[model samples]
Target: MSEATEVKKVGQTPVSNSEAVKVANTSGTTPVDTSKSTDKKKKKKKKRTNISKIENYFPDGVYPEGEWMNYDQDFNLARTTDEEKRYLTRDLENQDHWNEVRKAAEIHRRVRKNVEGKIHPGMRLTEIADLIENTTRKYTDAEDLTKMDDPTSRGIGFPTGLSINDIAAHFTPNKGDKTILRYEDVMKVDFGVQVNGNIIDSAWTVSFDPQYDNLLTAVREATNTGIKEAGIDVRLTDIGEAIQEVMESYEVEINGDTYGVKPCRNLCGHNIGPWRIHGGKSVPIVKNGDITKMEEGEHFAIETFGSTGSGYVTTEGECSHYAVQDYDYDAPSLPSANKLLETINKSFGTLPFCRRYLDKIGEDEHEYALNYLVKQGYVQDYPPLVDIPGSYTAQYEHTILLHPNKKEIVSRGDDY
Candidate 1:
C-alpha cells in the first residue's frame, strides 16, 4: 500500500495502488488544459507523481522479492527449515492455471463493479444474486462453455456469496427467498470464477451508509497491508500480524458510541491452487503462532476482515455452498444422491459450489438429492459465517504469486 495519499473519498474504495492514484487524482480539482505552450508565463511544470509501479515488485517479472520474514515473538522459529518453504508450493507453477485464475479473478471483479448499482435498498436479494451469477457467465467462458476450444476455459468455481448487513459470508439467497436490501445496509458480495479448475477467489463489501465508512476503511487498509507483506520469503505470521495491526488501529462510531475495531480472527487469508480455494497455509487476521513460510511460486489470496463486533464468526442457517467430501467414495446410495454426486464430481471435483449451480436438476428432486448427499457425508456444507447479530463486517481480497525476489499481483486489472 502506497503512503503517498491519505484522503479517501466517500464510496471510492480502490483495491490497488494504481487504483488509488486514479481515485485520488480524479477526486481532486477539475482537470486543466494540457496544451504544450512554450510561453514562459503560460508554461508551468506540473509535477506528476506516479507511485512505484506494482509490476516492479516481482523478480523475472513474475515473482515476489522480500527478506525472510521475522519469526513470531511469542513462538520459536527453530523448527522451520528450508524444506518447509518447499512444502508449501504445489501445482501453482503451471502457466495454464495461472492464466485461468487471473482471468477468473478479473472477471469476478468486473462483474462486481458492474452489478454494484443493483444493490440499492428494496432490491430482492435473490434477484441480485441471480443477476451477479448470470452476469458472471456472460463475461466469462461460461458464455460458450460447450463450444469453447477447451471445456475448462471458463465458468464459476464457487457459489456467489451475497452476504448482507449482519450476515458475514456464504449467504446466497435460497430459492424464493424474500429478503430485500435495505437502506444503510452493509453488503458483502463475495464470489469466484474458475478457469479449467483454477479458481480465483476474491470479495468486497458495498455500503451506502456513511456511518460505517470508517469500518470499511479499516478492512481495506488491513487487506492492503497483508498484500504488501506477501512475498517469497515472508513468514505467514508476519503477514497476519501486519493485518491485525492495521485492523486494530482504528475505532468506528455508530450512533454516538465508539466500537473497538478488530479483524475477524476466524477469517484469514489462505493459499489457493487449482480448484483449491483454501490450501497451503492459513494466514489469520490475528497472529496465532503458525510458523509457516510463504514460498516462491505459490499463489495466495491475502484476505483481511475488519469487524465492529466479535472477531469470532460461526455457522448459521442452511448452507448454500458445498463440495465433495471425498472424491473416491463410491459406496452404494440412492439413485438421486448417486446422480447428484456424479454430476458434482464430473463438473466441480473438490471445489466448493452452491445449490444454484444445479440448475439442470429437476425442480422437485433438487432438494431431495442435496439432502441425501449431505446426510451421507458425501458432500460437505458451507453455512453462512456470522458474528453476533447487529455486527458490521467488511472484507477485501487479492490473489498474488510470490516470486523469488518480487511479487506479482495477478488479480488487478486495468479497471481495478
Candidate 2:
C-alpha cells in the first residue's frame, strides 16, 4: 500500500502499507554499528531465560475464554445495576474469548524467553527475527506459519524497538539490510502473535547498563500498581492514574535536568478478544479519559509503561494495515453498525481482514472484500508510522483473566 492511501485509518486515506514501512524506516535515526568491547562482560552477567512450564503454568482447570466455574458477588460488582448486569454478561462472553488469547500470549512470551537471553548483540536482526518466528511456528495454531517468514506477511511481525541506541521501534530488518546488533546499545524486543484469534501483546528491553536494573524495577513497580488497582466495576482511567502515580514518585534528574517520565502517547495498552487484535477500548497507562470498569471474566493485557522523554506522540505514518470487514453499501459500519451484517456475510468468509490478502484484490471490490473479511473475523488493521520520528518505548505486559475470587495472570515468571 502507498503512504498517501494509508492516512485514512478505517477508510481514512490513500497511503499504502508499503509506503508506511518506508516512511517509518527512514524517519528513525540512522542505524550505526557499535563496538562490543563489553561483550564478554554481558556474557558473564546475562541471566538465563527460564520460561514457565506449560503444564504447570496453565493448569487444566484454567480454561481460556472466561469460563470460571465460580463467580463471586464482590467480583460481580460491575454488574450491580440490572441493565449493567446484562451488559456485564455480554462482556463476560468477550472475556471468555480473551482467556484463550491470554493463554496464547503467555505461550508467546515463554517462546520469546526460551531464546531471548542467548541471543547476543551484534547478531543480524534477521537472524534473531527468524529464531523468534521459528519458536512460534512450533506452537502456533495458525494454519500458515510460513507467512511469518516474510517480513510483510503479518504471520508474526519482528522487532523494531531494539535496533540500536538511536533507533526506537517499528523496524523489520530485511535479509539484505546490513544492520547488526552492538553491546553498548540496549535492545528492546517486542512481538505479538495470535492463537485461535486471541492476541498476545508484549515487549521487553534488554540492557547491559547497571542502571537498566533501576529502569526495569521502576517500570515493573508501575506496571504492577496498574494491575493491582485494576478490577471489575473499576474505571479504565484508574489504571493509567495508578501508573502515573507510581512513575511520578520515581521522577529523577538526568544531567542536571529535572525530567518526569510518561508513556509515549503512541503506546497506550489495548483490549483484545477472540476476533480482535486490538479491541474497541484502549487502556492507557497514563490518565486520559474516564475510568474504565473492570468486570469479572474480562480478559485484558495490563501493560504499564513510561518513557524519559515528552509523553506527547504523533503518527503521520500511513496505515500499513486495516481491519477490513464485509459491509453493505446501504449503511455505515462504525457506530452501532449492525445493519451491514448481511452484506458482510455475503461479501467475505469468516476471517479477519489482513492487508497482505487485500493487496491482491481489485480496488472496486477491495472495500467490500475488506468489510466482508473483517466481518467474518479474517482481517484486522495495523497502522504504521510514516515520516514520523521514533521514540524510546518500554512495556511490561501480561495477558490476564479477572476472576471473582482470584485473578489469573497467564504469563508468570518461569519456575524452572
Candidate 3:
C-alpha cells in the first residue's frame, strides 16, 4: 500500500492523500505501519466479561448456585454514592458488629479452655457443668435488665451443656445429678457466648481413650467440611450435604469392629442472630432441601455430631436444659413461674439457659420453677439426647461470619 493509504502524521487533522504524502516525506519517519496499528486496535477490542456470571468463588462447590459476588452489579445500578456502596461492600458498620462478635467468641474460647482443661476421667458431670458456668461468669459480663431490649443484657446466651456419651447435646447437670466421666467416655460440651446479645455458638468432644479418638476426629472433619463449603449466597442445603458426605467418609474402630461414621440426623447446627440462638434456618447434618441463601453480615454455628450408632438421636431422659418459648404471650400468675419468666426475659431472652443457671439468681426449687414455666407455656425444656445403648457420639462446632470474600470462623481457635 502507498503512504496515501495512511494519515500524513499522527494527531494532526486528516489531510488529503496528496498532502499526507508530502507530510510523511518531510517528517523523516517511515510511513505509519497501518497493519500494526490495526493489530493494536484489535487488541483494545478485547471482550469485557460480566463477572456476575462466573462460577463459584470457592472451589469444591461451596456455593451451590455458583458465586454471586457481583452484588453491586446484580442490583443493576451502574453509579452509586459512597453511602449506598456500603450496602454492597463491607463497611465500618459491618466491622463494628463483627468486632463485638469476635470479642465474645474469644472470651468463650479462653474461658472454655480454662474450664475444660481441668476435666479428668473422674470428674463429676455436675461439677464440670458448674465449673464451666462459673468460669463463664468469671470471664463474661452479663447484666440482666427488666426487658430483653435493654442493651446492657449481654452474656452466656446458651448455657453450658456437658453432654456425655450418647447424649449428643442439651445436657447440663441439674442440682443433684451425680454422673461422672469415665476414662473411655466421650464428652460433648455445647455452649455459647454473647456480646450485647450477639451469639457465637460452639461445641466439641473430648475423649481420653484412643478408641474413641476417631469419633472426635470424624466430627471435627465434618464440621470443617461444612465450613469449607460455606460462602456468600451458598445454598444452605449444600452445606449440610457436604457435611454428611465428609462424615460418612470417616471410619472408626469401636469394640473390635470397624464402623462407618455419619452425623445424627435429628440434631443440627443453627443460624444465630442477636438475642436469637436458633431461629433463622436450621443447618442439618444431612440435606433437607432448604434453599435459603446465606447473606453477608449473618452469623451461623457450623456444627456436626457424628455418631458410631444409627445416625439418629432421641430425647429419652430428663430435660436439663431450657429456653423461653419464643411466642408472644403474657406471663402466668404462679409466683415461681413469674419469677423464672422475669429472669429468663431479663437475661436469657429467647436464648437457651441451663436449669442450673437459675442458681445464679438464687433459685433452689428449679424443678418446680421450670415445671411451672413449662406448663404455663413460658418455657420449653430441651431434653437430653439418648443414642442407641453402647453406641458413642461426638461433636464439633464453630461460629462463622459469612462475608462475601470468605467466612470468618469466629470460634476457630477452639481445640477440635
**What is the TM-score of candidate 1?**
0.74
lDDT of 2 by residue, 1-416 (tens): 01224243586667554555556567587643322443445567666544333445556725343223222336454445565555545556666555556556556656766775767756776677666755664545332432433222223422233333323344445335556766544455666666555566666666665544544556667776766666667678867877877866665443345445555555556666554545666777777786667766666777755565565544433232444343445544453234333332332233233333333222323455445545656445444332223333345666566655445565544521
Query: Which residue pairs show collisions in model 3?
Result: none
**lDDT (Cα atoms) of all candidates against the true structure:** 0.70, 0.52, 0.72
Ranked by TM-score, the better of candidates 1 and 3 is 3
What tens digits encode model 3's per-residue C-alpha lDDT throughout 227-289?
A: 777766777888889999888988999879998887898888878877888866888889989
Which 10-residue window of candidate 2 scores lowest in summed lDDT? 150-159
Question: Candidate 2, which segments miss by more than 4 Å at Cα?
Answer: 1-106, 141-170, 251-259, 316-391
- Who is ahead in lDDT, 1 or 2? 1
lDDT of 1 by residue, 294-384 (tens): 8757778877878788888899987788888855666536987777777666666777777766653333347788888888798888899
Ranked candidates (TM-score, high to low): 3, 1, 2
Give residue 299's error in model 1 in angstroms: 0.8
> RMSD (Cα, Å) of candidate 3?
25.9
